[model samples]
Target: MNDSGAVLPWLVIRQDDNGNRYRVGRYATRAEAQKMADSLDARGHKQLYWVERIGQSVQ
Candidate 1:
């Protein structure tokens, strides 16, 4: 949950070429989003991939 109290799953993704990060989409749970991220990595959709909870700050 966030300050707004909205409940949803979220994940972070980045493009391999440009190193730009963006939100993949909302899912039912964190695990599902992580699975998607892993799938992307496995399939070579993205060279650099990451998955994290919504509202989380990445450094």
Candidate 2:
């Protein structure tokens, strides 16, 4: 959460070759989440990574 007391909206998700999906992390902004996904992708692995907005925030 940021100063606004709201849950972070951005998420970094990873999908492995086995099709298992995992939540890497959450960020306050999409850019931050995308950057993390890109950095992980640069590692040259079979796993796939991307960013998305949270469908629903934590109460």
lDDT of 2 by residue, 1-59 (tens): 76779778899988888888899998989989999999999999989898888895322
> Each model's TM-score?
0.65, 0.81
Q: After superposition, how far is residue 23 of candidate 1 from its true place, in Å?
A: 1.5
Candidate 1: pairs in clash: none
Error of 2 at 4 (Å): 9.9
Model 1 lowest lDDT segment of ten: 12-21
Clashing pairs in 2: none
Each candidate: how many clashes?
0, 0
Q: How accurate is candidate 1 locally (lDDT)?
A: 0.71
